[model samples]
Target chain A: MKRIKSKTAIVAIVFSLAGPLSAGESLPIRNCTWCHGSSAQGFSTAPRLAGQREKYIENQLLSFSAHIRDNPLSQQYMWGATANLSPEAMRDFAAYFSSLPPKAANDGDPQLAAQGRAIYELGIAEANVAACLVCHGPNAEGIREIPRLGGLSHAYLKRRLEQWGQGFHAAAEPMPQITRALSPNEIDALASYLSFVAYESLE
Target chain B: MKVIGLRLALPAAVLALVLSAPSRADEMGGPGFSSQELRAKLDYCKTCHGLSGQGYRGYFPMPRLAGQQPKYLENQLRAFYERRRSNPVMANVAHALSPSMVAALAAHFKDLNTNPIGGAPKEPVALGKTIYELGLPEANIPACSACHGPEAKGQGEIPRLAGQLFPYTVKTLGNWSKERGQGPAKDDTSFIMAATTHNLTQAQVAAIAAYVGSLR
Candidate 1:
């Protein structure tokens, strides 16, 4: 795992040095596209950044730089990818990516979508799960520093929720507290529902 | 032989009395809910209210529950269940709580003495303080201290204004008549503030909200 990270870091550094040859020009889009996908649609383990909240992307980039987002993938990939990025460059990257239209992953169980919708909208009050819409918005379009959860892959959404409870990234306050109340079934329902949410891009 | 039988019967009677005793003070809900169960419920409340019950800034502002009067808390819970208060999420939450659970939850939040969350604008604070203490007599607004208490800690069903979330207070005061006192049959305590809330302008409400929200 360490070897792979070092190699990725070396390639990232080389890419940074070889970038498009002018300050304030287009961000080295290729450097990110290599793993984030040619269209920035997220490939393999990478989370989709397209049409995400600009402030959220900026905050996450800062989190990477500060080593505050300590999730395994964030530690392995994003730390190196963002390590050499200047604050101006990070802001530019975030702004550029946030404007692009995002596609729904649509990769969760179809049968679970209804249950997920119920949980997201109403929450399981008897179980003490607060409605996700209270903070995430009715359509799961996040505000400000909160990332948009709509149309993210089920695996990505599920893992992020589970990781908070597992004590991975402690910096995202209230998430650890919030997600702790969700049962495993609730998580699956939420992930499934969110995966199917139709994209509503705010250009 | 009869004396021996009497002696044995006396011990049996004492054992029966011990078995039928009311039980320990802290063991609420008897065998129904453990201390762990109550703690879980408290954690749930804290998720939006903040870990220390200091309030939080979600998409919709969640009010501070720390240092709230237990009577006020319990009344609000019952109000939510009874539809006298009009928050859909809270209504659902209140519906699920039993009377004992409501009492336990209310008492639990009342004792938490966390600091104010503190996000109100500083510009209006002085004006807010003046309004809070002195009121706009020309406007016929009674001093808030008269009802909310000097420190805004509140009494009985009035609810504590101290350390409340600015937005929550603003929304509550702004939408007082629309949201609260809706059930015609149950007039409730919210009506006491209806005329006051009605007479206060938006600026005055903001000022009062900012002032009280800054209290410890």
Candidate 2:
């Protein structure tokens, strides 16, 4: 009888521990966590969905559905992930992921941070580059539809910036125009600087 | 000795010519930006100010410069340069612009007639229209139309309020005393709206902003 009681307790403990993951099983969030980190912090190719702007994530999901955000990685992974995703599902997923706490990638050259900060704050006016802070916020904490740029991975940020310059997300106005103004060195600096930024909470 | 002197003279002359070449646009023509230079500067302005100078909602609301009065534009630019307007971004931007460049930019933006990027809450629009047209006499506020013109297209140093961003107008009027009239030594036209801004309630200000912001 004591052995039977211990088995039931163990089963209860397992179920309790598995609650969050099982919740995703019903919501298809498991598919996302497969590419994105288990905690939605992001993995190799996928970006951190945690602490992202819900609106921005929704917009990107819609963009992916429409094939508007045609970057190579986006085309490969996100396109399939977001395809046929219902509006309700999109909203739920965006809300869930964005609510999660984010961790900084912290994978950038430390030396280039200052130069990146300068460009992000003031922009290279001679090059007609607008300040990134004007839209991205003081600490790169975005508001409303603007995605939170702080703590995004260096590789992801750099690629997005480069892709914009290369004419991938043409419909994402101001970014394409803005990125066109950024030089290669400036892009590298900005990516490096943004990668190291750690935020305590969601914007 | 003659050959060495000739070589040195040639290189020195070349260096002098290169060094003396006009580095800035204003240097090319006495106190004026050349056409190419003006075009480049306009592009810079548009990067933040919108392609048509219609203004944009960035981290901060970039005000609508399109169809703005040239005098107002020039004054604001000078205000930024002089620290009367305490905006770090605009201060740096304005410092780079010379008098002629300012003039050229002002003229360029004044000619633009883009549609408003309307995204204000429409529920209070009617109340806003009323406040804009008929001021609260009890509160000692004059009808905005009286000075801003019936259409809110301001004259001279007064700014054009039509199609201005709702948030920008609200912020400007709400923080009028703080942001503008900062230079006690140099009181400018921003004082014209000081009493009105002070008298208007937050709701009233929002209404007025919403009304004028949606106009053309």
Best by DockQ: 1
Off by over 4 Å in 2: A1-24, A201-203, B1-34
Q: Among the candidates, what TM-score does chain A have in each?
A: 0.85, 0.87
lDDT of 2 at A198: 85
Give the clashing pairs for model 1: none
Q: Model 2, range A1-203, lDDT digits (tens) per residue?
A: 97577557545644554666553354667788888987788888789998898988888899999888888898888888888899888988887777666788888788999999998888877667788999889888887789888888998899999987666777676687688778888899999999888886433
CA lDDT of B191 in candidate 2? 73
TM-score for each of the candidates: 0.84, 0.85
Candidate 2, after superposition: displacement of residue A113 in Å? 1.2
Any runs in candidate 1 off by more than 4 Å, and if so which?
A1-26, A201-203, B1-31
For candidate 1, write residues B1-216 as lDDT tens digits.
Answer: 533343244235434433444352264433467655766677678777887788888767889999899898888887888888887788888888777877777766777788898989988989999999998999999899998999999988878999999999999988867888878755578887887868888898899999999998
In terms of docking quality, model 2 is acceptable
Query: Which 10 successive residues of model 1 chain B have the least lDDT summed?
Result: B2-11
Tell me how each candidate scores on DockQ against the true complex. 0.25, 0.23
Q: Ten consecutive residues with minimal summed lDDT in candidate 1 chain A?
A: A10-19
